[model samples]
Target: MPDVKFKHVVSCSSEDPKNPAANLVAQEAFRKWKGVAGQPSVSVILQLEKSTKVRALDIGNEFSAFIEVLVGKSTDTEDAYH
Candidate 1:
């Protein structure tokens, strides 16, 4: 959402140089985040600036077959995504 602000990218598997992961949060529709070829799968972890409850998500990915959203706290373990 426009209210949410991302601090930085914690980690990312792949991303296009022209269209980086930061485009995902950008308001411009022309700019988009695209992964490189030859990869089995891709993943990106975007860290938020603050702890805020997300009631909903707006996913608009037509290129990928599927996408999974994982939410976790700074103190929670990897398995805590549920």
Candidate 2:
């Protein structure tokens, strides 16, 4: 498996500062879920220390009604997701 880690929140459409983006990377099932009041479409960007080829992802849908995954290389300057 790729050694993935949360780098930073590049941008968020909406967020509750108290419940931050870091919560998405918690090890334990902590009460840390990033929230947006009215916005249904939100975006979060995560970075990897080194290059990686992601095959699959496991995201808990406890809070989000729907979710989408996008992958890109570190060198890309724009949000050109694959």
Candidate 3:
């Protein structure tokens, strides 16, 4: 597996500002889950230092009725995500 570097959080649909989406990239396994509730759906946007093909993703203890993953090229504009 290639070294994966998490750059930053571009956006999130709903999150407890206190907890923050950035917690998802915590280096330690002791980090708590980034919680978002009272919403029908939630989304998170993350930036990577380099473009890479995501073969797999590991989500911690969180519940979602549905999950969707969309990959875009590094050169893609903001509109490309929507």
Candidate 4:
């Protein structure tokens, strides 16, 4: 099996651009999600216009996340039999 790839996108904002607490808040939030296994290509989107509260949007629906997993070999498996 090929190495699987995953993408995690998080959206958050800061009340004050100069406030040092903002970084801590975001960092903690990211840490929580990072603990999950098989998670690669993590990304974060910051919206300075919005409040400090973190908001997440599920890629598919209310019960699901936007994370995508792709697994497959780069080479052709069909030739294995030959």
Q: List the residue pairs that clash in candidate 3.
A: none
Stretches of candidate 1 above 4 Å error?
25-31
Ordered by TM-score, highest first, the candidates read 1, 3, 2, 4
In order of lDDT, best first, we have: 1, 3, 2, 4
Give per-residue CA lDDT, model 1, range 1-82, as digits (tens): 5567777777788997887888765756654677886676988888888999888877777567779998898789775776
Which 10 residues in a row give candidate 2 its minimum summed lDDT? 26-35
**lDDT value for model 2:** 0.68
**lDDT score for residue 28 of model 2:** 52
Over the full model, what C-alpha lDDT does candidate 3 score relative to the true structure? 0.70
* Candidate 2 Cα outliers beyond 4 Å, as residue runs: 25-31, 63-65
Per-residue alpha-carbon lDDT of model 2 for 1-82, expressed as tens digits?
A: 7446665556666557987777666655663556576767767776766676667776666456778888887788788898
TM-score of each: 0.75, 0.68, 0.74, 0.19
Query: Residues 1-82, candidate 4, lDDT per residue (tens digit)?
Result: 3222222222422223343323423533332223223443343342232223324433322223565432232243632321
For 1-82, candidate 3 gives per-residue lDDT tens digits of 9546778777877777767787766665554445567778777777887877777787664666677777665588764853
Give the whole-model CA lDDT for all candidates, comma-separated: 0.77, 0.68, 0.70, 0.32
The whole-model C-alpha lDDT of candidate 4 against the native structure comes to: 0.32
Error in Å for residue 79 of model 2:
1.7
Q: Candidate 1: which pairs clash?
A: none
